[model samples]
Target chain A: MADESGVLVLGDSTGGELSSMSRELLTAGRKAADDLGEELAIGLLGATLDQPSQQAISYGADKVYAVTHPQLAQYQVDLYLAAMEALCRDVSPRIVLIGRTNEGRELAPRLAFRLGVGLAQDCLEISVDAGSKTLLANRPVYGGNAIAVVRCNYTPQIAAIRPKVYEPLEPDSSRQGQVVSFPVELDPSQARSQVVNVVEEAAEGVKLEDARVVVSGGRGLGGPEPFKDLETLANLLGGAVGASRAAVDSGWVPSSYQVGLTGKTITPEVYITVAISGASQHMAGCSGAKVIVAINKDAESNIFKEARYGVVGDWEQVVPAFTEAVRELTQS
Target chain B: MPVSIAVLAKQVIDPEMPMAAFRIDADAKAVVPPSNIPPVVNGFDENAVEAALQIKDSQEASITVISTGTSFALDVMKKPLSMGADELVLLQDDAFENSIDSFFTAQLLAAAIRKLGGFDLIICGRQASDWDNAQVPLGVAEILGLSCISLGKKVEIKDGKVSVERITNDGYEVVEAPLPALVTVSNELGQPRYPTLRGIMAATRKQPTIWSSADLDADASQLEPRITLQELFVPVRDQQCEIIEGDDAADAGRQLALKLREAKLI
Candidate 1:
């Protein structure tokens, strides 16, 4: 399962399941291995992970290092990171990559500390330094104001990449790979931060991340009155409702419902911005949407520049008409 | 009681900087701003300052303000000293800002505090407005080997032990930890108070002591930047504006419908 460059990716599992960001890491890992002419191996650390290992294989992992143990079933920071660290020590990988999720953010740093090397987090981009084989990691700095390139001089150069930045490889069901199940040795008592409870959000229909169509209202909605209109439109079009940071800051909307850098990053099929001015910080989260439509009174609003289609009219007049038209089309 | 408390403060680019001042220089491949980008004590840090002051008001603890920044920070950081931190430590060497990662910053602060000694609590904003890393407290805790509770929206100290109410998505988690712990305050904790003119006048005479990487006994290798920033620029957007034209309301509805159909959204 070792590549020519000996690069291997360790897939992170949260809540006893594979995270969405893991696929993106695999994509980047595969690309990096391809560039280095190495086979990209994946170390999937979990308790019992046959299905997720096969899924990883389909996503361009050459070999899956299936480290299993009853103690590793849940995310215990110390135990989980120790398992991955032990795997890397044995495998002797030249480069290691992980998803920049909560688990990755915590694990990579601790693992790097244990391994006595530097670890990079939240990298928007990564490339191998041709001369040095140093993994160059580009991460957002200054609150999305600037990007800094981070490099590791130590062996097994590690990186944690943000999700959605790298497109996942086409999954092939027939793809084949080896799964070597290794026994993990650790006790749960060693964990620092215990997960007392795992509570999932109540809303089930369409997660903000996975939603194809999103209708977002902002502070300009004035109050809860226009929210009904926005929700009506979202429901009519089978979309989720998003709100700008301004709306959240103004207390017009909950922070969970806000869409921006601090909020959830969405890559919906279509996004409608109602009264959003498209500030740079806010745009970072929503820029991934496929089709953007801006509806604002100001023709020169920043949202207009980012939207694919815009209406420079009052949303009060435009929303109802837009809702009716969507119903007419979807119903037909 | 000889209890000393260190409050972490940061100077950030004012959150309300005008958009008109933002300009992208193609040659520099960076965002060129008009000279009016003023620095201020980050709003969250101000909350931390007020929290520190509240403790100093009643508990009779020595309050110290610690910050990591460059020359631009000195002006804005004065607010905290005026608000009543008994002393100030500014880590402003060239190497400090060059690296300035959470781990390094925490290491430096912990070293400085260790030199001073006898600190009961360390106060800081839950997250900084500029970096928003939220790692300093955790990093400091790990470095100093102390207990830390973050996102403290409400804090109360009694009998030398601290009671902190942490705001989470569900509701709040109230935890009681012993003294010599690190606590970071958020906006949800309380609004920061405005300094009076008398307080401002007193602050004018106060000077924060500047410490370098050497002063903190931090190794050069430990403080080096892991991430290198190549460029900074605003992302390009590809939005096109199209007005749905019609003379009447019915015509407008029909036109909008036609536009949706044409785009295959129907």
Candidate 2:
């Protein structure tokens, strides 16, 4: 082997199954490994690992390093960071990919700082230069107003890929790979944050990313009352309601309603935006949708440019009619 | 014992600026601020400040705001003070121009934190609006060996530990950490309190304690950038939209719904 240098995917799990973000990271990891002609290894932290390890392999990992410990079951910066640092030191991989999940948002920077290397956060694309073997990435900046291409100067370069940017590889059950229980001596005393309880917002139980259709509103909605109209339409269409950053910032809606670069990233079958001017940041979160339908008053609004179908009209008059039509069409 | 809290805030170009006015200075490898609009405190940083103010509201605590940058808008940076922060500290220096690298920024901020010791907690925004790196708070925690928590919408201090209602993909989880921890807050904390006229007058009467790179213990070599910016530009899009037309706005709305039904989008 040229060296112990390869791509390592920092895998995560939810409810014992492989997390979607982890699967997507494997996609990016597999790409770099293929380009570099090196093994694609995944590092997963948990109390149990047999199933998640195999799942990672089925998603294209050639090897799985399960960093196992009793306290490692959940994510804590003090404990998880220690284990990841130990794992990185042992594997000595050339590239590390972390999903920009809640955990990754915290871990990637700390990991990069701990390793004394560099990180490109919230990257939408990553590639390795063939000649120099340098890792490069395209990341959105200025709230996704622009894109910046960055390069890492130090070894074991790290990146936290934005979720939904890369599609997950289809699982191949017959695909065989090796898994090793990479043990770490975790100190419970060193840990700081303790998870008391995980409570799901009941109203948001219908996840936006999982929805087939999403009807979203923005500043043009005027106030929170209009969101009820959007909710009516979404329910009629069997979808969810989303809000632009403006609406969320205006206190017209909770931030959970927001969908943008800083908010949530959703890839639905159909995205319907109402009275929303599509900012690049907002588009970044929903551009992957199969079809985008925009309803706005401004004909010159940017949402039209990214949408497949659009209506230029006041949302007040348009939304109610749209809801009625959706109800009639679905009822019949 | 009264708790000592440090809130880290940054002044950034108004993210609310019209997209058409957003520009990239390829020659400088930086974003060119729109001349007509003034920079404001980053949106998320205001949330962090709100988190601190909420804690202060319930307990006997002192809030000290800190910011490290090449320069800052005095009024903008003082918004935290007007919102109830007891004191302000500005780590303004040319050396921070290398803040493009989170490592440098972290080292400098950590050094300043160390110099202003006795802080039981450090709160920062989940990420800044400009670079959107979301790295400095975690980096500072790493450099200072502090316990770190991210994406907290609700934060409180009790039983000698800080507990945060952390935002997750599905919902939120209640997390507790011991003192000397770092917490990053997001917009879910709700809008920051508006500065009252009386508070504004008091803030106007107050002056911030300023520090430079030389005031900290960090060395020159420790601030070298690990990441390099190769290029900066706006992404291009070319999707041509089909405008649905009808007799009136209401008709167009119906037509749009019918269009979606035809495309099997629903």
Candidate 3:
């Protein structure tokens, strides 16, 4: 009976590995399931995702349903939507959770529409309402200036949870669960959009999402050349270099390195914001960082209000020296 | 054959309005439109219009602009018309006045598109600036059983096929689909061109065709929002700034590093 109506978590895999966002969703799903007195099930759809299915079990999924097909290697809207829709029909879950990833954003809405369910996109928090027994999805609106607690009036409530908002539980190697193979058929003609090629940006060191220490520069840096100093500091800290939307829009940095509402959301141990005014949109992405250090010449900069430690100084004069100090401190 | 393109535009409260001026009525769970800052075309939707206009510029094509809301300020909605849209269709009804979710919006928009007839392509912003929910384009395409390319930075139609450069996490991907599809344009496509004097004057002569829910034959039941707003509030921050003092800028940098190290953050 529990298998028939459990909390379903959509496991997103990239390059045959479970995405960080998927793991985060599982963590969130676990809590919601516990609160609702239901079991948690994970759905993995890909050409090859056996390893990630087992990993999901260790992360707290009681059952793992994987659908594999050759056409599932690359993300196609039709194939994925059909697979998930089929799964939902087979196992009528009370709630469905998907990561707010590139693919998830596209798939979640379509699934909800097909299921005739309600959907909450890019949610920051998810919990069960004690009295109503309905799911409450907290999402930011108006560029993160305010948050709205949204509830779906329909069954099988669906939500696309943002990455880094919930921490994944520690994996227990000894844990075991049922792995079910779900069959799915794909026709070549169904795929309207075909991915000709994927071009990855040339980036060295840690990826922005995985970086523990993020060194981000803003328009305050004045130009792209100053990013070199940020790179040096990021390298010394063994982290990644990021940028504000202003810097990216100014053509000082590529869009991939941007950190803001329209860009990637990052939750690092330490986020060093240089010359950023901390616009609400930008803060929406990095507010999850454990500690924020802001450096700007303007004392009234908005970034300072959110930063744990702030230095009112020019980047050119402060960054190089800061890099040198960090290098020395880490070398010893 | 000349191509027919329909661009979806939305009027949203300017996202760039300063935080201090932004206000929300918690009880109503609605944003109080700052009178000083009037509603403008969502920035990304402007990019979508620009994408459609560029295609219109290079080829023989007709561009139709569509928007759905309770009341669209003509002054704001006419910006797309002034920029060279062949026609503007406004979907307005009192039932849509409240907080309608994306599903209902997409369903109505899809129905309206069907009523318009003979559109080879549909374009929409990656997401609205106010709600920031990038779901409508895909939802509309799903309802119409059409292909959708999301976050397209570049789009072109030739020989009844659509080619698009889609923005990805790392970089971008080149994808292709048959005509009679939809694509959502991102800001990476570039800033939209401003209207010229001649174009503005021509817009003054053009009137938008307004369609209510009755004309579209929209199902009032389906038009109802599935999602309900439970509560709305501003997130409060308890942290205060602790400015690190230093003799100079460089010294301040050193002190900052030391403080971070002490916190074991580095």
Candidate 4:
């Protein structure tokens, strides 16, 4: 499949499956490709293909390319960049999409710099300019205080899309697509950095990103002890516990629990904020939530402005009562 | 020989400013600076300085702080020095004003680093607060052919290599890169150290070295901007929060839960 001049999603199959972010990229890619009247191709690079090639097709990829190399087993910036640069050059896709993920945050920039093109990072939306057929990206800046619409002046424009902003298409198992093996030579020695150990701090139930309900706390929670109450509420609702950057910076919670522009971007069905001031940066992470609930002593908090439901009260007085009520309701 | 470290910091509009003060001059396609508050060094960049200073705390390392912009508030730019960095270098020019192009910013910074060579490590913030490009450091590493490890919550130099506890979604990975590498730090690294009176006094005595495109043999005329801003505006929120009222705080809590349940949100 030498079909070029279309959209290419630099999909990630880190866990031997299509990542949710990768799937989100497809939904965004499909929209952009459809708008531009171009084909959408998805590329996966790793030592082992996650069988996500078929998964990519089901998600909306018209063509799938798996670029594999021994050195590509894990995300080593040098090898991934080399393989991806080679893949882009060979396919010459007009526009490329990468998830604004932890690895993608590094990979996208390096790849763009390598390709000698421009990349709009952490974009909330990617639109097609009909007349120019170029990619226009809207990204949050100044800690999500404002949104800037940006355009790539050169071909092979790149974008790192924030996860949770776009929903993935439901998979159709009956869909059929061919997986092309694009060969990219990579020498393991070319890798400049190596990961010697990985520590898993989040080894419990209800991953933050996958949670439907999220109860978050902030500096106003006073100390780490209050997190237990939030966790209790989250557990009752079968949700996850989150934190504001202030909480994380205060060492009351781990960085993994932080929700903000510089932290994790999550979209839950029911997002409850406890005592958070709702900085625009914090709002950037949870704005995609279907509904927001803010509980703060100060009614003027920016979070209430973005929330669907709110209460003006001290978290110490309100949270336990809310938790008890949620528990009672869930038990019934 | 003392290990040489280059720390890249940026001064940006305060990210902590109130939402109401965040106004975009639509006609200018720029954010209007709030008059009440002044700009500060990017928070993550402060983390980078702390990371470098931590290395200095344990080992013999000379830290040189570099910042590029159309202008500088010298006092804010000298923050790293006050925090115990050895030297300060400012890359300022008229062309750098309202610079949204991360690639060009990286190019100029890379040129400055090249002009002041012999550095074993380069440290920068994960991203700037204004543009949030998160590209300049990595772009510089790409141009300099240096190994780059990003989002380091804990950075240490050992065995003549940079070891970083790189933050991942669920946890962190211990990544190691050889010398002459680049690393970007985040807030997870911990609060940067407060500038001591002694350190601040020393910083007052030391003068910053200023450089422009002319000072460094970097080409700027031929380069095209990597990103062009089409529009800048505050995103509107259509949410109308129903503030659940009650006689007391606990009653309000109970009422809010019932409201959510009534709305089928719970």
Question: Highest DockQ: which candidate?
Answer: 4
For candidate 2, the docking band is medium
Sorted by TM-score (best first), the order is 4, 3, 2, 1
- Model 4 sits at an interface RMSD, in angstroms, of 0.9
- Winning model by TM-score: 4
Per-prediction interface RMSD in Å? 4.5, 1.6, 1.3, 0.9
- Give the Å shift of residue B142 in candidate 1: 3.6
Put down candidate 2 lDDT per residue, A154-198, tens digits, no spaces. 878899999988989989999989998899997799877888999
Worst 10 residues of 3 chain A by lDDT: A1-10
TM-score of candidate 3 on Cα atoms, chains taken together? 0.96
**Candidate 4 collision pairs:** none
Better of 1 and 2 by DockQ: 2
Which residue pairs does candidate 3 place in steric collision? Answer: none
Write the residue-wise lDDT of candidate 1 on A1-332 in tens digits. Answer: 23325578888665655566777888898878877777788888777888888888898888888888888776565678778878988888878887755355446655665665556666778887666666877766555555555666567787767667888888897988787887768875555433333334323366667778888987677876787788888887778887886676566555557676655678887888888888766776787788788777787777777787767677787777777877787888
Q: Candidate 2 — which residues are off by over 4 angstroms?
A: A1-4, A202-206, A249-254
What is the per-residue lDDT of model 2 for residues B1-266, given as tens digits with 9 covering 90 to 100? 88999998888999888888888888898988899999999889999989999999999999999898988889988999998889999999876773457888888888889999848999999888888888999889888988878899899999889999988866788999988899999888888999988889989999999998778899677677889999988888878899999899999989988988898876
Error of 3 at A38 (Å): 1.9
Q: Over the stretch A239-265, how does candidate 3's per-residue lDDT look in tens digits? A: 999999889878887778988888889
Query: Each predicted model: what fraction of the native A–B Cα contacts (within 8 Å) does it retain?
Result: 0.26, 0.86, 0.81, 0.87
| Poorest stretch of ten by lDDT in candidate 4 chain B | B215-224
The window of 10 residues in a row where model 2 chain B has the poorest summed lDDT is B94-103
The digit string of per-residue lDDT tens for model 4 on A55-77 reads: 99999999999897777777787
